[model samples]
Target: MKGVIRTILLIALICIFSIQFTMSMVIFTDLDNHWGKEHVNWAANTMELIDGFNDGTFRPDDIMTRIDFILALNTLLVKKNIYQDVGLHFGKGINISYTDVDRYHWAYGELAILATYISEYGNADIEIKEIFTEDTFNPNKPINRHEVLLLSRAVTTPPIEDHIISFKDVDANIPNYNLIIESVNNGILRGYSDGTLRLDKNITRAEAATVLRRVATDVNYLADKFLVYEDIKSRNIGIELPIFQQIDEHESQSQLHQRFIDAITSIQYSAFVGHIPYHERHLYDMQPIETLWGLKNQNYYNVIGNNYYLIKYDKDLVMERKKELVKEGLQHLKLNVNSSFDGLISFLSIAAELLPMEETMNAAEATFRQSDNSKTKLETGLFIMSQYMANNEMDKGLNIHRSLLEYEFADDIKAQIIRNYGYLLYSLKGADEAIRILKDLKDEMDLDFNELNPNAIEFTFNGLMKQILIQSKN
Candidate 1:
């Protein structure tokens, strides 16, 4: 029973992130080649920030209206869990009223919540001057590119310093020059290829999505997505420790629940049991749960039944399993390398890519450069490319990656490089090119992309390639 429960939770987390990686982000037929497609898909799927019309087409090219912007912005804030008590009731009751948006309107609650949220929590920099004029909000008007940035500045964290903005058309004299520049600097707004800011052009749905995702998601959340499936199977290392607790007659429900919570808290979701064994590392999918019910729901453990189990992973099994996988990877590549060092480098490179704010990358790079070996250099380049992609220097990263492909190495390394390159092409180069590259390898290798369970995803090569081959039916 305990094994059954552990298996269930592992499968679910894998399916979610695996498909997210492999498949197309959106179903809107119009989004096939749209430059902003990735943003649109992320906003629609990850944030639940927007949806297509009843006809099934996203109409992504259409100009985003004022009302549409408000609804999406309000959704982003709520989904991000930044604001509390932001519905029709704000703990102080419905405190504000809009002249144009009345109680009868369908989105009245959404509009009201956003307006009140901004007014209550917004800084002096983000005044509602653009929307509210003469006691009436022009909700139907097309939202300008700059207007969205001004409103977003109210909710988002500031862009990192030293970010380049090359909007040749945006002169300093323009009223919202700073806001427009900030948008570009934040990686939200990109001017056309001709170098014109087109400040006054009506923002499209795709463009609006690009603006919203950058404003909503921070570095930590995005990085966590990478580490979610690090287990040998699905990347979740948690397992069930069966605790058989009989139902007490005299004890109240609250009392019994507290006991369960205490038992759960005692089992730590930590990195490792002891010191680094052979320098093998393990990453567990750690979800923080405060209440007993929260713990039960997340782990799929049954507190209601007579038998219960606390969830914890076996560290020895976790790391050893990873070591076995790394060996297989080395064999497939037909390369004679130290399994421990190669695996360590793989994990280190990922850490550098995901947690860029940490000092870990510099140490990892030093080790890479010192080795002066082909494997070290290749993985090190993977790390550097990821950082460059993160910083919006895609062209430079792409060019460097192309050169890495020319490096002579094992079949495994070549496959690794090809897949990694295809992965970039998946996001920046579009799905078709990515699929073609991967399919060729799949055909040549005669590989099976299936995982441990038909429904779940494994971190193995086959599981990863599924993401590109499968398009969204949405």
Candidate 2:
């Protein structure tokens, strides 16, 4: 009975200790005022990815050196077994080639492994030219804010929507401004509350711990790339297809959206035979809508809907029609930026991708600048920005939209400007920004999810707003 009692007590004690450890296994004394305190604790105590120099003091604000980051990265991969995913085995095949880092160096094994990987496999997760200009491994060198961008992008598969953030200090023409914008968008780098990126600054120890924790724990970082139907293709299988198709006479708005998703994502079973689905192509965060369609048969129909239709969509027909559209769209460029409506859209889509954006943007900028009427200027800006949204050239589009919004406008024009901006945000999967921008409009306006496509069958504007809010929370 005494033994049994002792065993019960022991089990209870173990469970309590585990609960405490799980709650916060390592507490840092210096992180009381730091924004990344929790991340520091999680990375240190939970994942064992980082550690304090001494008992209970994490020294969270100290600048991290290159070696510290490399070791933290090594721990994240090796200790947590994420290295298996990347096919990295640290000790073997390591060559101590860096002039500064000898085999006896504290971080030699990890540093050597990284060196070997980079030297042999020129195509690393990030471009080699982005980092490592020389043979000297400056392991103790303080990593700059911009350098973290190179590391974070290599480590985390976060979304890459540029011009998503701006700093008061960063000018658009500066060499690093665009990179900083993208880094902020990726959540790898953040700005001060006062709106400065302090681009020249080195990241503190606290910041490094948080960034490392993000790579270790953030869902967006660890998520697998997937194929949603809309990513593979679109509504038209080339040629002219009617907006409404093979009737689901009583389909709900949700069901209609699902149908749209299914149509673009579907394929004939025979067409799937030699294709490798779920390919692990996670070398870098893919740009939006990028997918691996490495298939033996490249031709697949963009089946319009679930139900049968009168038209035949052969592989050859589909390919030829798409080519013709591109060709026609290119030919429409004869009207140049002067084209209106569909012709204008086609020109923008093709030209934005084909022509040098400098030339295209220069011509576009002149048109808006030359317009004397506020309405025409707004319309031109909105039109060009809309094309940018459509073509996934959101960074350039965002710049155009911002310039338009800064101008003083009549209330109605201002409302339209705000709405157009919100619609562009919505297209970029920026649910929060979309809602925020739309709410800025003081009057009743369409909040529908049909900004890009007038005939898009989705939830009502309010419904979609609510849906995305719920999703964002999740």
Per-model TM-score on C-alpha atoms: 0.40, 0.42
Worst 10 residues of 2 by lDDT: 225-234
For residues 1-474, what per-residue lDDT tens digits would candidate 1 score against the true structure?
999999998999899898986564447676788898777887786677888776757888899998888888877776665555333342332434667666776767766666666666543144465434347666788988767766775554344333556667677776556655665665566678898878678998988887787666431122112211111211111123223222333244545554554544343423335333343333322332234435445432222211112112222334444444333322322232211123333444323333343454554445444444455456556665566667877666656555665555555455445555555556666655655655564466554443212211112233334334333211
Clashes of each: 4, 1
Evaluated against the true structure, the overall lDDT of model 1 is 0.52
Worst 10 contiguous positions by lDDT, candidate 1: 229-238
lDDT of 1 at 70: 83
Model 2: how far is 343 from its true place, Å?
Answer: 52
lDDT of each: 0.52, 0.51
Name the regions of candidate 1 deviating beyond 4 angstroms. Answer: 1-26, 85-98, 102-106, 131-135, 162-177, 219-474
Q: Mind giving the per-residue lDDT tens digits that candidate 2 earns over 1-474?
A: 999999999999999999986666666677887888777877788777777876778888889988788788767756555555556677755566667867777777886665554444322234433454468878889987767765555444334233566678878786445544654665666788998878668888888887776555432223322111121112221213222222233344444444333432333222344332445223222221121121102222212221111122233335445444434433333333232221232233334564567655555566576654343345456556655666778677756765776565654445444444445567674877766654454224433533212222121233334334434544
What's the true lDDT of residue 265 in model 2? Answer: 37
